[model samples]
Target: MFYNREIYKILPEKAEEFCDFFEQYIMPVQIKNGSKLVGKWLTESRDEVMVIWEYPSIEEYRKIIERVSNDQIGRKHQEQLKKNQPYLIKTEQFLTKRDKPERSNQNITVSGYIVNDVGEMLLVRTYWRSDTWELPGGGVEDGETLDHALCREIFEETGIIVKLFGITGVYSNGETIAIIFRGKRTGGELRTSEETKEVGFFPVDPVNLSTYVKRGKFIPRVLDAMNGQYIPYEAFQVRPYKLVKRYDGEI
Candidate 1:
């Protein structure tokens, strides 16, 4: 979850008019895309307007923003901005992550960190998460080992069979826990799956990662996997009391 706040400083006695203009042009499109308005407030002097919005996740927020800024909707928003110039004095905004609560019944997910022979990293864009490109992987199925899950997901999403080396990082929000694995592409051709709209390798530029992965919570995971230390991972069967395999990891 995430929050977005907009602060608008308007000319004296213009708060109501500004709010009305915003409600007509911007709020509807945002709501249609699953953004919720937390509340709207005015200063004691009634010269400033402040509104807070909530979104289910950063990726959803990104998709909503893109929807609101493109085609006819974007033109409408721009027109409103021009009209508000008479009353608008200044504007400010910031985005923040929601506080995570204690976990219960969290869903486990897996993602793969794969690089190609020429140093391009694999990424995929899905129809649902269309606004940004993300690492190729998905939810772990029951009865599947972590390594097997990562390999299968990578193949299913990007048509690339991978040789996973080690665990890159373990991350959790209140609702979901995600484990990332580091590996290199071993075989198969690049192609998109039904779940993926676009799939390919892209250059990993520190200055440009945000262009592809706009979600705040996701960028760090990619960076940590790309530059951080790798940890050993193993699969074993408790009933048989036997170790199936182990990954020594690469630096």
Candidate 2:
């Protein structure tokens, strides 16, 4: 287990604003990424605030931090901090470890890289991610298989039914695990859904990938799918169990 003892010194007049900012921009994201708040305290003068966070492991702590910094909401949080710097005087942190603590549930997501015979990859632009085109996908519904979830998401977002090649890559960032699959469109017309603003196929040019995908974390997933390298992935049952299926060798 690891703990983060975070101390924030702020102007007494800015205390309310700081607390609001923390609650609105920071606390939810941290909790969503598997960090737990042990407690929060305010000093006698009310100029200093103390927060303790518990994590199952140091590695998990690092992943939560990294994910918060890379994701869209995290980016917004950073900008808010810079924009509201006057509320903070100084920040201090302490990291220490002991026995591992209980961990929160992790969110699982699936995405697909659907390429056409002509070499262009299917991509979508959402309202939140309008800056760069990204693969179409979403959170896995409870009890759904990864491959099935990906197929359903693709159809919902881009109206495309796909012939999956296999698992192209897997990624983990503390609280979330994303499985990326490689495939090509088998049928269905291109149409935008409520979650997507635009949907179409675009050329996958390595030299110009950055122009299409500006998000650092998303670029590698696209690149891996483009290269055609695959990881053998399978899902199985445990209890009154069975071998559900596998997504491999099709690439």
Winner by lDDT: 2
Q: What is the lDDT of residue 20 in candidate 2?
A: 88
Task: Put down candidate 1 lDDT per residue, 36-92, tens digits, no spaces.
Answer: 788988898888888888765566577778766763755787887887777676564
The C-alpha RMSD in Å for every predicted model, in order, reads: 12.3, 8.6
TM-score for each predicted model, relative to the true structure: 0.59, 0.58
Query: Cα deviation in Å at residue 182, candidate 1?
Result: 0.7
The candidate 2 region of ten consecutive residues with least summed lDDT is 96-105
Candidate 2 runs further than 4 Å off: 1-103
- With candidate 2 superimposed using the best TM-score fit, by how many Å does residue 123's alpha carbon deviate from the native? 0.3
Model 2 lDDT per residue over 1-251, tens place: 46788888888887887888889887877765556788888888889989898875566688778867875767898898887677675465767643456544576789998988797899999755678899999777546888888999999889999988688888998777889999889899999875577999998788999988889999999888888888887888888788888777574
Which pairs clash (backbone N, Cα, C closer than 3 Å) in model 1? none
RMSD of 1: 12.3
